[model samples]
Target: MRLTPFRAFDWNLRSCGLHGHVTYRPDEEPLAERLHTSTPVGEAWRCLRCGTFALGAPAAAGPADEAPLVLRGRALRDAVILRLLAAERGIRGLLLLLLAYGIYRFDGSRQALRKTLDDYLPLLKPAAMKAGVDLEHAGPVRLIEHALTLKHSTLLLVSAGVLAYGILQLTEAVGLWLMKRWGEYVAVVGTSIFVPLEVYELVEGFTWLKVGALVVNLAAVVYLVWSKRLFGIRGGHAAFEAERHAESLLAVEHAAALA
Candidate 1:
């Protein structure tokens, strides 16, 4: 049997070796000995992240339980996913903000724009006809006409609503991009709120974009809840911390047992 060559993008491992090396010492003698060693030049300590010894004193020292639980493996994967989601939110937020600004500008200059369109539209009619284009009934022309028909108050309210939604999107982006626990909660809640609206839009008019958005939102909510163990789910905060400590403890025991 022949084995297929495989490639893997081990994010945390790469991060540890390249940029995020975490070294530590424990107060306990036996545990400390496993992590620290004598070297020709000086003392060296094992990196908690990649298990590679570093030729220097430990960056941090504390009880084994207090050692930093730097993100690794699945945790790093979670950070990458959250940041991607944050990027999506940031883009949507900016687009919504631009839309809001456009609406505000249109509301303020509705009469002038309408006058300009009316004055210029007829002048282009002959050229439009020659080019096989219906300038008067074009999408942009129809949209402008319809927007002008709306009351000023309605336009202002719509713009304000869009602006608020855009601000909310930006807030979510900040939290998720930073990978804060509160941000995860914010994203989960915010996304949950939009799921129904997305579903309604999908039901009213089926589109792949809406379907994709809906799928992403639901998946994010599930991932955050299950993996982060939020809101009393799957033993919640205590269990979450315990799991991290457990990983560190296993590493400590493995190193010490080897000695």
Candidate 2:
């Protein structure tokens, strides 16, 4: 029987499994040792008898548990979006803090403020009447009056709550920007806590602003839950990792070749 000469194949072995160089020449070390040093290149080896390619050993664990390039890009995009939203929350918190400060300042001049409002009522009443609104009977007007007349203890409590909430927003922003898992949980819970309030506001009075806020919050919640695989939704982290691995270039190529 005659042996057919073997030639180097045109395809790359790196995709199959070979990480580095492979030498075919005779060397001082044994052949088995040399072959052992070369990582297995699946289905890329050639036989000396017929020059046909032969399948090698199964692939080892990959370099790292990395997702597909596209999936990584998508994660980056989502992170950017979440960070931007987090920044918006931070700004909102700051604004709320400023409002709280103003309220605290007003608490000291409640009588004077009430007098001023009462004096302006004559002017406001006419415009409100023209607009078919009753300023005297409006819920917001009553609430503002109540807030202005709050005792010192009540005012301090309200201001403290606002400051604490603003700090929470800033905390969430930092966590999300860093892509910490805990941040996602905090964001979900914090945002969800206000959903009912937002819904109530919409029910009481519809406005484009309220609708938009509700929609955005709902979108963020859904995106984080589904895409990030939070709370064991869609097989949780393990399944998410598996899905990412399946999308890798090598895996895709292997499946196509098999097909």
Candidate 3:
């Protein structure tokens, strides 16, 4: 038989033990070959190249590798569904921001807003006092309300922006969870766009908790985009194609076996 490099085959040696050595030779050649094959106690084969019996007996026949049947079915379907869910979440986040903006525009009372300056006023008081706002006459609540109302439009815009960002984050998270390679790319690009802004915010204000939150978000974005291999657009497509081919091969094999 013609010897091919890197070719794998199953050889059956009747008398060889698990660690027996066997010789392989061209059907028409005078050269003797030795190789080792491994096998369980009763079924062993030897490699013709080496006299060592470490090589195990080869099976009569088998496929090179078994495709993961379950992953192709339930796992892949689940990934698709998750991708849809992620997209929906992003849309929802966008709607929330829009609703916040609507509330800012329609509701004159600052307290009426769902997420308002009133909520963040407590956190800002210490800063305002440090910035030389008189606490005696200007109570924290009053001061914050006045500032918020003064910049009502700006605050609304900021809220809308944050909502939009949240939506984007949701999209990326969902995409990653679902294994859509494009989701990963989009997530990385989108999140990276915000990194500088987040850094600026942290530097300007220097709130411990907010800074921590920014750092965590940044780290997550980097991990998903780089190390996870989800953002490799070409690689992802290739993986999908390979999965499809494996599925097709499995189907064909099953059909043949049934036939």
Candidate 4:
């Protein structure tokens, strides 16, 4: 009777021991020594050093208490999507804010420019009145002049902030779109840091729009940190280890079968 090449060869099992080599069947002598031998077949083929599978596909060996390995993949994908959406939202918000500022600063049409000045005049009045500015002559032209005189430093500071924020948001959007882990972290940390400040603004102003913005931002923070799974202190490391372990197991099994 003719035997298959694998059966006639007494294929050496690839060693998963700390020292990388192959172990032949003859080497499986003393029980203690056999335990270290890499020739075990079927479900029992495990690395002596890591207790990982030495043949076939690696068995799922994640923490017993944790969810199945399949779930981790879904969770990671969901987290990544949520992070990307959050980044997009931030970029949109920044763009809108910049657009509003641009309309106020450089709208060329006279009527539109005047309307922009008029809309903000009410907010400026209280400050101007406190400084004893006469409003009778405060038309668009004089009003703009007075605004520049009273709030030049404030406008400069706010403009600088908007520019910086726009750049940061754009960067964050690009990072998240690329599905980078660091981008996930940055989105969670940066957005969460602003929650308290937004809350403070809501408390001070108590406007419906302000309240809504605060609520939306807070919800975004919660989703990214908890549901996305990227913000977990150990999730990234655990996922990386699982990938490496799977690869190593596959390599060993392939080598053993070839041998």
User: Which model scores highest in TM-score?
Assistant: 1
Residues 109-189 of candidate 2 have per-residue lDDT tens digits of 888988987889888998999999999889888887888767899998898888777777777777777777778888888
Model 4 score (lDDT): 0.53
Q: Per-residue lDDT tens digits of candidate 1, residues 60-142?
A: 87787777767766677778898999999999999999999999998888889989998999999999999999998897899
Clashing pairs in 1: none
Tell me the tens digit of each residue's lDDT in model 4 across 1-259: 9868655421122222223332222222342233233444643333322333345433333222221222122443464566557566566757857765763474334456557667877777788889898554655568565554445456656666767666666666766776566766776776777788888887877889988877776776676565445634346557655654564444333334433
> lDDT of each model, Cα atoms only?
0.84, 0.64, 0.52, 0.53
Off by over 4 Å in 1: 1-6, 119-142, 248-259
Candidate 1 C-alpha error for residue 251, in Å: 5.0
Pairs of residues at least 3 apart in sequence or in different chains that clash in candidate 2: none
The TM-scores of all predictions, comma-separated, are 0.84, 0.60, 0.41, 0.44
The better candidate by lDDT, 2 or 4, is: 2
Give the runs in model 4 whose Cα sits over 4 Å from its true position: 1-80, 83-87, 90-97, 100-149, 227-236, 239-259
RMSD values, in order shown? 3.3, 14.1, 15.5, 16.1
Clashing pairs in 4: none
